[model samples]
Target: MNIPCPYCQHPITPGATTCPGCGTSLLREATPQSAEPTCGYHPRRLSLAICDRCGTFACAECLRLNSRQEVVCQRCHALEQDTPLPWDLREELGTFTAWWKTVVAVMFHPDTFPTFRPEGSAGESLLFAVLCAVPTSIVGGLSYMGFLSFVPYLLSSGNPSRDSVPSWLGPAMFVAIMILGPLLSAAYTVIQAGLDHLVLKMGGVTRGFQVTLRANAFSQAPWLLGAVPCIGPYVAPVWGLVARVFAYRGLHRTSWGVALAGCLVTPLLSCCLCGGIYLSLIRTLGGFN
Candidate 1:
């Protein structure tokens, strides 16, 4: 009579306590006799053993065992060996794209926004970068334009000099710009690196965000070319192009023609916004005058 061990689904002799092949305990009671072949591993007189991997049913004699001693049919074992692991490119892209969106959201609205540490320790770095960049950018720009110097000038005992621009204002603004400009740049670079890391993580890429951020930072070292005097204007466009390229690569996990479109559009949009603000401020000042 055919019998099968219940544990490992391997075949065993009738009335056996354990399976010789898989060490699974056999049924204590003997199964009813039948003309049809019963599973050698199951004493319940079942027709087949189910393959653990692919769920194929096979008689005890048909079962092929593996190193794990789990019963698997021949076809399943062969397919298991041949099949490759699953990869989801779209899931990867979603993850990175989500991360950058998070960074932008936090940057523009930190007071109301909350930080999420989906990529573990990276959340802290991202938060630090944002905290530094926003304030630095605003304050640094104002200082570069000499707005803050008016405070000390107003407090001075003597009346203002005849110079078109105030003497103290130029020196104060220069000091603020010199001190704050590089600091703002550094903060922006750091924030950008964090955002890049978040992008890589979102793309379902298992690589650490810190590693990706470091690599991107190194690749973008050319952004420092903005430090040059006559050459600085040209450097901004190049840096913008590089930023768009990196954004595309990190967000989509693949190259596409739209990346060039982003390069062209982003700078133009920023300029328009800045021009609008400048015009509004000029009108307000003129109304007061």
Candidate 2:
């Protein structure tokens, strides 16, 4: 007589104690039949081995039985337990837009933009922007007017002498530069600071207003190189490009769409504002005549 092996269903001699196909132990005596295997993922198989993480049962087909008897679903077991989800651009943009509104409001009133410190209010950032802009604009405007005077001196074919330049023109240019230049610089800086604040609030630590300002300052080095007459116009774009780079970096931390828009529009806006001022002054001086 012969019997079927319990492990591999192979036929064996009646006295055989193990399955030849799988090396599994055979019944020593006739035993009762057992139930079918159950799926590991199903909840009804509570008595079966289950995955420790996702809580799925283990069976011959569903079981990921390992040497240690530790079993888990293939999908859940392979996932990285510590990895965080990627940031959502839309959500970041929304947060940036909200922070932008706050910045605008604070610009109108210095009391609004808060500071990170205990004594600092929301307006501390705005205050810093104003302080930096005032001095930088004053110095920058004076330097620009001084540089412009060189054009006339060069045209006059005279050794550049400050005394020869018209005194009234210098003071007039100074006043004009002081009045318009600081306001423009202040506004631009405020906008940048606001954008940086927004980026911080949006869970981005890669870029900040201080970093942007430092980068801009470094980029302006090329503009000084623009002092070479014919090269001035060509090199001037470097300053504008630097500004756009800062803007794009800030936007990149927030949203790619916003960065794209900023890269296209910021230079144009700066040109319009600064150029309009320059052209207006020229017209007032009868340069159009």
Candidate 3:
């Protein structure tokens, strides 16, 4: 994003201290021994604003609006851009709306991720993953519950052993599916993201694990489709994987190849391992026969 130079109205690039068109100095010198506060970094310069992150006096040259649109000192801004995700502004946007907007952005406007700060807490990302898991988990649980209820009717028509299905089983399954499923999905999201981060590290990512975790969580935006009954569950994972590639690349400011490796390597390896194990099991069983 560009900001206008107050003097010439020239659009200045982000983090620039000098105006190109006007050749004007953005920083102003504080009068000697004046009551006005001087910049923290430059004692001779007057403060234009206080840094939001460090709460220190900052001159125009030392201040920049971060991705969150908060004015912070260049030093603090460099450390935490706090790229504004709608989900992070839940207090203002409200929870569900923030989540929906973030999902839409992740699914449709993935290019926007480059503007997002790669810094976020694991707790925040996990909460997002859990929210993304909710619709599918609830739908799956309800579907299972319905199937369980239907099973008794189907078995009763031709069998006398139908009473073998316990009465408490349906409710227990419902609780487990509805309550535990989303939580498990969130846990899996964290684990999968951690594995992806390891791949990113191999590919030369310098950012912390939280960056990968947040990317993974945001990529789960496609999982909202899991509310659509049977096909939703199948579609979500595939769509999410595609989104994950974009998320990793955009957030990490990495090459597309590195992003793809980070998102795909672990999953591909898992699939290959599982396939090999299955083939081995089948061969062993055939030999026994």
Can you give the TM-score per candidate against the true fold? Answer: 0.31, 0.28, 0.72
lDDT of 3 at 113: 82
Clashing pairs in 1: 3-40, 4-40, 4-41, 4-42, 5-41, 11-41, 92-203, 95-202, 96-202, 96-203
lDDT tens per residue, model 1, 112-133: 2111111223333333333323
Judged by whole-model lDDT over C-alpha atoms, candidate 2 comes out at: 0.44
**Each prediction's whole-model lDDT (CA):** 0.47, 0.44, 0.85
How well does candidate 3 match the true structure in TM-score terms?
Answer: 0.72
lDDT of 2 by residue, 148-265 (tens): 6766667567555556566567557767866775466456655654553454435443444554443232223233333345656485556445444443443334354444343446
The lowest-lDDT stretch of 10 consecutive residues in candidate 3 is 10-19
Best-matching candidate per TM-score? 3
- Residue ranges of candidate 2 with Cα displaced over 4 Å: 1-167, 175-180, 191-228, 250-258, 266-289
The collision pairs in model 3 are 83-117
Q: Of 2 and 3, which scores higher on TM-score? A: 3
Please give the range of 10 consecutive residues that has the lowest summed lDDT in model 1.
81-90
Model 3 Cα shift for residue 123 (angstroms): 0.8
Instruction: Give candidate 2's TM-score.
Output: 0.28
